[model samples]
Target chain A: MNPSARQPVRATTSINGMIITVASGKGGTGKTMVAASLALSLAAAYPQQPPLYLDCDVEAPNAHLFLHPTLAEQQEVGLLIPAVDEAKCTHCGKCAEICQYHAIAVLGKKTLVFPQLCHGCGSCTALCPEGAITEVLDRMGIVERGSAAAGIAFARGVLDVGEPMAVPVIRQLKKWALPRPGQVVIRDAPPGTSCPVVETIRGSDYLLLVTEPTPFGLHDLRLAAQVAKELNIPTGVIVNRENGTYPEIDAFCEADHLPILLRIPFERAIAEGVARGKTLVDIHPEYGDRFRQMFLQIYETISHS
Target chain B: MKILLTATSPSIDSNVDPRYGRGAYFIVVDPDTMEWQAHPNPGIGASGGAGSLAAQFASNQQASSVVSGDFGPNAYNALQAAGIAMYLFGSSATVKEAIENFKAGLLESVGAPTGPGHHQH
Candidate 1:
């Protein structure tokens, strides 16, 4: 059954439970696919109490293609940037000096503002000795809330094109979708070990790190592992295409004492399904049970730890 | 009119700093009197936006024109908007020579920024 055809999912009826964030050290490691499938399976098992699926990868959010949520509400996200009051101005050049992004430039009496380059840190406004600067809201992106089948409450952030910052939208998304007690929250964090990934996974109870058994994968996986360690978040590995003799990633996991939660073998059909925007679980219902079992393991680990 | 020239040394004999935003020092001089002061370029170590900061410095110093080897896009726009003419001074040109060139109308006027921003780092 198509998820959108179902009734609205009750996202916050439960208690203070774990927020599971699914992240990868590198891109294209099936991060979104796994997160989506896991959310779908959890929703299926808990029909009355659905999980919350948050696509925190604002730059390139694609989980909605598989979830097919019917977005019932949409809201715009913005950042507070500086706008100058020119009439009362002395050409102090202080605003330009204070702005690290150099968003403000004072050429004699001419003040040029580069809105695109502004990080909206308010440094210019705060340090403006003449008080010529005031804070203004600039649209960053949009956040949409919807419900998919199996009672999953879905929320995703779509960043504005050419926007470098992703944390604000992610912050707003998390604030909008507060986790309920005993209810599962699965976040599809952006790839890489950058600030965006760190921001998304910071407060999560458990981090499901996805990787492949290869040299590049293992290298980035180590970096991701280190981030989880630094954040003090308990983490496990889910190696994609695990049917391989590549012992590097396995050895690293063994050495690191990280649990291998679940593995999907090297299957062309799964890739083909993903290419068509159909998740592996959608193509092969059996994988749904596999993801559910993995969730159980994660839950046990979270509970015990 | 006061003119700003990027310099590596405090004196006019110093070679022109080829960089605009990241220049080590900015020398503001009156071409006729040759009166000048060299101030440290605060934008040199800036993570980004050095160009704009440098341009703003030129305006605050009351410079009608600026001479630099290179200008980033941000610097070009700021200087241009301020109605300050920008001239290109090669590495071989000394600060004294650049001032003379500006007075002699021999310096090449730059309407556009020379290269991408942050290329120095």
Candidate 2:
């Protein structure tokens, strides 16, 4: 292992539960494909465990595209927005001055409000000496939870289109799928190493960074690795599309001393299966055995480390 | 005297207990002297508005100043009332470096970091 690359491992009591975060630094790295596939595999491997699938990719949540979960329950995710009572007309600009997100703006005897920027932390409401600032719930997104046909409990957040932030939606989705002992939860994280990605992988037991063998993939893998390191989480790499090219990936891993856990060879069947909205393990039973073995390898690594 | 240098960890590095929208880390430093002390961040991942979470930490420690990467207005105002000083760490710099820069008086007070389209409820 590279001396600088060797991270300090802080061991804690093994909680039979795992929060597997599937992420890629670059876009179009098939993060969702691998995340969804593993969730399905685990559900089949340990049927009694009752694994929950959480899609933390709020910006563009598409795990539902593969999981096809029925809408058993649905609700809006709301944040507290500041409301100004015009009747108590004193445009003192106190609320605007107190707003951190710039959600409130003041002009000559008039104030404008933007509900989207409001974090609902209730600072404006408290700071408003005029008693004009109050809180009103503004819908941010929706959390939908239900069971897929394959017996996986799936929960995902669909942020309202045009919404720039995804953390609120991701947080709500997590609440929907609270982790339970003896049962595992798998999270399909969003692409990129931004705030949304961090939110998704924050509480994970182990992070599985899925990457392809390309320049873009290597760059993103490195970034995601740093993020994992900063969070002090154990990380492993899954090489997707392994057949074509991987010299750069191998070199990077060798230099970083990162463990390469599993590699999925590029196959027409996998591509076709994905295009058809079917899992590779489902289309080819042989791959099912391979994924089962992969799961075993993961379990062994977690057990030892 | 306890001098709390309030900070926020990236949402991903945050943990439970500090129930903020984004994750918050409380650096309980020695007052008048900038010596390192305990970091009260439970290390649970969190996301969303940090006003309540930041308030929880400030209230508990009676913080004097907040050295954060970025803070919304709501969180900033709350910390101010709690007698906590708030500074922005928007750049790719360390908390210590930012503090040093601020003390050297090289930092400009940007007031609050929140702008349109970036605010949360």
Give each candidate's fraction of reference contacts reproduced: 0.77, 0.00
Candidate 1, residues A101-159, lDDT tens digits: the string is 77888776667887656877888888888888888899989998888767788999999
Highest-lDDT candidate: 1
In TM-score terms, which candidate is top? 1
Tell me the deviation in Å of residue B88 in model 1: 5.0
Evaluated on CA atoms against the true complex, candidate 2 attains a DockQ of 0.02
For candidate 2, write residues A199-229 as lDDT tens digits: 8989877788899998889999999999999
DockQ for the candidate 1 complex? 0.47
TM-score of each: 0.82, 0.67
The TM-score of chain B in candidate 1 is 0.93
lDDT of 1 at A250: 82
Poorest lDDT segment (10 consecutive residues) of candidate 2 chain B: B11-20
Q: Candidate 1: where is the Cα deviation over 4 Å?
A: A1-16, A93-101, A121-131, A243-245, B1-19, B22-40, B67-73, B87-108, B112-121
Question: Candidate 2's error at B37, in angstroms?
Answer: 45
